[model samples]
Target chain A: MRLAKVQKESYDEKEVLLHLKEIEENIDFKVIHKIYYPYFHFEFNVLTKGLMKKKITSGCVIDGVNGRGALIDCEPGFNQTPIEADQTIMEELTYGNAGEEAKQFMYRSASIKLKSMSVPVLALKKKTFFYRPFYVVDDGDKRSNHLLTIDSITGNFHPI
Target chain B: MKLDGVIFLVYLLVLLGIGLWFSRNASKSSEHYLLGNRSIGPAVTAMTMQSSSMSGYMFMGGPALAFQQGWYALWYALGDAGGAIINLSVLGKRMRRMSEALSALSPIEYLEKRYESPAVRVIGSVISIIFILAYVFAQFIASGKALTALTGWPYEAALLVGVGVIITYTVAGGYLAVVYTDFIQGIIMVLGVTGIAIMAFSHISLGEVNAQLASIDPTYLSIWGKDLAYYGQWGVVIGAILIYSVGYMGLPHIVVRHMSMKSTKTVKGAIMWAATWNQLFIFIPYLLGLAGIVLLPNLADPEMIIPELAYQFFPGIFAAILLSAIMAAIMSTSDSLLMQAGTILSRDIYQRFIDKRATERRMVWISRICVFAGGVIGCIVAIYQPPSVFTLVIFSFGVLGNSFLVPYVASVYSTKANNMGAIFAMIGGATTNILWTTLELENPTGLHPFLAGLIISFIGMWIGNYFGRTPSPQIQEAVQNAKTRKKLSNPLEKKISQDMASESKVISDFVRKKMYINEGDV
Candidate 1:
């Protein structure tokens, strides 16, 4: 499958590992496996009505697992990549229904920011499926067998 | 029906109309019916929460307490004045975010999900259903009394009419109906009470009233209450204040307000609205109660002070409208309580245990049925006039506050809180309140039942936590997320990234070791 991935702009593997070690000194980190989390990305041409009509480019990313859509302030670059069958997780939200949901989310954000009853119409400029990278690490604690995920993009930690 | 009765009937009809109008929308989905699709804005959220929390207790029970106890009753009012402010500020934002994250439709369901235990759901549901029903019964009785005073009907007939209207509207309209009507009722309540207070004050200034009260009985003017009944009983005084102040945090019906708010941003505006409305609305009833002692010195039932004061101060049509305010207070509270009880029954109990696969339509029907049954039962019990509205309200409110306050607060604030801790806290607090009230331990211990129960509940949480295991990492992360108000800065994010490097390095070493082993074998 042709899977699209967000360009890794932050850190390489060795650098990421070095940073992770300084944060969590207690746990004996075992193995790290990379997994792809699905998100539907959309770019929109938002028209604002004021003294002058202005067109602004905005983007949104909707979580494929929970169907939660969020407006992204800056557009992130993406590239097409071959999906590794073992590393890719399936998305629960279908691409067919995500467009309308994404549009509604973007519209709300634009209207709120513009504070206008005459909210600019949002035209979809581009839409695509993108996979975000996350590193899942096992804490080799025999007693608890804990697992934690680090967002390769943002470096946020979520213990599961 | 009299003019007042007719006005009240029209009001009831209007409420029923609103409920039926929303019924179509409410039936479309269980979420709509139970939580109004979380679309309620700040103003409506604040009003509904305040009106529901105040209950008929404001019009009847509160004034009655003041009439009997004198200025000491103002202690309750003092706490109540800040009750919504405290509740909204402390729990509003975090609870809203947490409930959404957990996808919990009911407060009881939220507790279970937070604790990750079915047992928590069962215990929480049972406690909420029982106490919320008890709270509803108090409203039913107050409604009957207020209606009887207004229309000159027999208590039985008034009980049937008043409770009947409340149940009808609640069952038909669901949460949206309950909340919007509460918003309207909230307005009527402030207007009615304020009008009466103005007229009463105009008739007798506070100084003159105090002079007369002192002349009648010196104890009537005392802060310690009439005859110093609660003199030097700071524990009792503190309990009186805490019951309405912090007490609101524990009530499932009240806390559900947080869950159904439009968003976390709703909290700031809601706190402002609630604070303003509460300052206008809460202290007046107690002051009127104090005024009642001087104005209506020969009153038969102390609870009838507000209604009698309205009739004495205003003419027929105006007084009747004021009477409508009294009924509004009762009905506003009754409907919310009924809606909450029904939600608990249908969502927390039936859907969770009896039939997990029940469709949205069936669940709505079940909720309606539960509400109707609760109203009918409440009416039947209210007809017997089981106890004074003040007594019933305080008892139930005290128990509920004591039971759930610790657990609810812990859920958002403490990551170590587990299923056993919640269960113990709930049981300990409720049992303490019941025992303290039933055994009448306040006199002997010099402590209010509510205060005693709260102490025990907190201790129980601490002890039970020692025995309970730490919550799952996912739940801990959720608690952390709930507490976070702003995104991590680049520097902080980088620091976190650095902290997690050890795990990454270990994983990298393991993978490299496996590759080297494979190469050697080849």
Candidate 2:
């Protein structure tokens, strides 16, 4: 399973907008989230994902839009959505083999089968724009934790 | 008739007032004197960081270099820009967090804690005294040269006036005064360099100068020198400029800026401001230098290009302002270096090793006395150092870079490093730098002594690391555990250890995958 920082507002109901810039850079994830955000998370087969056929380990990460990372996990259905962001706006992000051949390290990870999640925000008639940033923490036993902020109303993830 | 005298008085008064303003706190605590309470604001921090790092070379001597060379000097700005960008993205976060955690009283003190090597600290403290004095002397020479050129004052008289200004401000205000004055000086520098560039460019078109230059010498534009009169080529430009730019990491004066910043949030913003302003302002000298090529072809002394251009194009008031700006650049650099060396000698070396039990009040007084003494020593050296101001400044930077920064920068990030590495690095760098300059090995290659010294130091540090004593494993483990909560931890952390540690395994996997998707393969 993979995750993006979720906006605090709309923590429960909204589809989070995870930056999928890297995925777009290589194999496009444009068709994955064309439909409305999946409720209760469902499985979707990735076709022609460049290296999609290769099975990934529990903590392996792949680049998506806006320099966001999409990690492979053992969790249930995770709805991976895409957003539009370029290199200039967001900082550089990397996973397995970025330039360096020897060093292998990451910010945080776990062995669970985790899918990706993003909360989308659409404020047509509301005055307040809900935004939240999520942080992933590691348990002492090598497990993972995600603490995302919840939105006040309409409950959707927002990006700055 | 007393225009120079009056202006000198005004400068002295401003510096004095600022120095005294911060002296109150300095007298109360060495913390304020050495580290400025680690609460410096972004604006003051930006100005102080850039101005101190620049030294007087950017003002008078740089233009003088430009006058002799052409567009090639612009590489200095590019190198600085490159360095600033790296600082923001790479070193900035790490420095801000690491310095805060260590709470170092001096640059070397910070190094000791970071590498857990007291030997590095001792070696660094000694180097600080030696090269800083040399660098400070260079500033004094630049200041004296500017004063003499502008007012035709006696060299000794000029040196005295410059010293007086440095002592007054630094003795009174301490870091706050230095920061405030640097902001003022930074503005003056920008105004001065911009005005000079504009006035100089207005005198001739690039097409005209290029044409004139071509008629004079076929290879004038080439990086390599065809005649005796030539600017440095790409290697010199890249090598020299690269040294100027990335070299900030190794510089004691520049590193202190990060330690003095307001907060972590301010680090990025301050960096952006300092980098942009520093790059643009310092770069203007390139145009002035190129213009000097066309305007004054056979001029033996290249340093006079800016002043000559000011006199040639603008009216009297404009000339006065340009002169003020030039002085602003020179004085601004000298004052900061004077204060830095004074504090390092007094608080870091004298107070640390000499009198460990000295009261904060007494230390502040000692620092003040050192400022005065340092200024005096610099004046004496500048008045008599080997002829030219530019050479003096280059020598000073060479000594500091090869010896001080080489060891200092490397020790900051590495845990396996030791005191042996620090000593060898300085020795190796200085030895190679001297050999290069003396043997003229860098002659055809055009690599500067400072850069050569740094490269040598890099090798020296490795040699030292291999032979030096390593820390115990238990101490190393404790340092690592403590470092886990650092705000500036490497992005590739194995475990999340901060307050955010309660996140779920499910969430961590999701976020990591999402994060990796954007990051690409790293």
Top model number, lDDT: 1
Score candidate 1 by lDDT: 0.71
lDDT, residue B460, candidate 2: 83
TM-score computed on alpha carbons, candidate 1 = 0.68
DockQ of each: 0.05, 0.02
lDDT of 1 at B489: 31
Native RMSD of candidate 2 (Å): 17.6
Which residue segments of model 2 deviate by more than 4 Å? A1-160, B2-55, B91-106, B172-182, B225-238, B253-274, B298-300, B404-415, B444-447, B474-522
| Span of ten consecutive residues with least summed lDDT in model 1 chain B | B256-265
lDDT of 1 by residue, A1-160 (tens): 5646654435445545665566665555654677666778877776655333455566677767656565553455666667675566667788877887686555444432322223356788888787776676666765565565666655555443
Please state the Cα-based DockQ of model 2 relative to the true two-chain complex. 0.02
Candidate 2 structure quality by residue, lDDT tens digits, B218-310: 565655443533254444455566665555444464231111101112244565566567666656666677778888777666776766776
Candidate 1, residue B359: Cα displacement in angstroms equals 2.8
Runs of candidate 1 with Cα error greater than 4 angstroms are A1-64, A67-90, A93-160, B14-49, B87-106, B174-182, B253-274, B412-415, B473-522
TM-score of each: 0.68, 0.62
